[model samples]
Target: MAVRAVRGAVQVDRDDPDVIFDETCSLVLEVIRRNDLALDDIISIFFTMTPDLASGFPAAAARAVGLTDVPMLCATEIGVPNSMERVVRLLAHIQTDRPPAMVEHVYLRGAVKLRPDLVRERRPGTRGPGGSTATG
Candidate 1:
């Protein structure tokens, strides 16, 4: 299997622990669902929270949903003037036969504007800049 990277983000209305945990889990699960990935296929996940979100660790939410053995990390997103607030983001590495072109990157809730260009929903047959194969 080839290693592929999946990216996603979600916006949280508040920094409350419950909200953060819920949103983080939802984001991770959606990524897995869209990519048709099993837990075993995930190599690791790196998460980040906008500086405004400080109530909890997004990685905890990941572990709560059966990624206990997978390596994960959490860090604060750099603070930029007027940047989107209270957002959680993740980059997951997975084993897959799909090429980057077929990979679907997700941006949900208020975070959609974070990466308008990468937010398109891509199905298995989709062709992106990476093109038709996993050659990269």
Candidate 2:
């Protein structure tokens, strides 16, 4: 199997720990589901949150999603002027047979603006940007 890296990001409405955990878990599960990956296939995951997100570590959400044995790390994103706020990003390395182009990267909530070209069309039951109704 070839090793590949998948990227994902989620924007939270606030810096609440519960919001962070829910959004982070949603983002992680989307990446795994889209890429058809299992926990054993994951080599490691690195998470970085924007300076404004201080409620908790994104890695904690990964653990909540049952990634107990995966090597995970969390850090603060470099504060660039005018960058997005309350954003949590992840880089997950996994072993997969899919080609790089076939590997999916997920960007949810307002984070979709970070990489519009990579963003998947919102699913029927999925939340839209900023976690609002897609049609409204």
Candidate 3:
């Protein structure tokens, strides 16, 4: 098995703890699912949130999702002028046979805008502006 790093990020609606937990969980799960990873395969996860986000640590959301024994760390991203706000990013190290090129990096919500080259088409049934169904 080869060690690989998976990346993901989510844009939270606000600095509320609940929103951070929900979005962080969603982002973490998607990264795991897309990479066909088992929790046991994870080595560690490092999470960083934009300076504007102070509601809670993103690692707490991973714990809430049953990552009890995993080594996780959370920190504040370096403040960059005109950077995106309310963004939480994760870099997960895992053991996998898949080649690095095959790994799917998840960028959900407005975070997709951060990595247009890596963004896949939005899944169906996703909500769009004003709560309408998002369609390609």
- Strongest candidate by TM-score: 2
How far in Å is the alpha carbon of 112 misplaced in model 2?
0.3
Ordering by lDDT? 2, 3, 1
lDDT values, one for every candidate: 0.84, 0.88, 0.85
- C-alpha lDDT (0 to 100) for residue 50 of candidate 1: 92
Candidate 1 per-residue lDDT, tens place, 1-136, comes to 8998999999998989999999888888878777888899999999999998898999999999999999999999999998888989999999999998988787777787888888664455643221231232
Candidate 2 TM-score over all chains jointly:
0.89
Per-model TM-score on C-alpha atoms:
0.86, 0.89, 0.88
When summed lDDT is taken over every stretch of 10 residues in candidate 2, the lowest stretch is 127-136
Q: What is the lDDT of candidate 1?
A: 0.84
Clashing pairs in 1: none
Residue-by-residue lDDT tens digits, candidate 2, 52-103: 9898888998998889999999999999999999999999999999999888
Clashing residue pairs for model 2: none
Candidate 1 error regions (>4 Å): 121-136
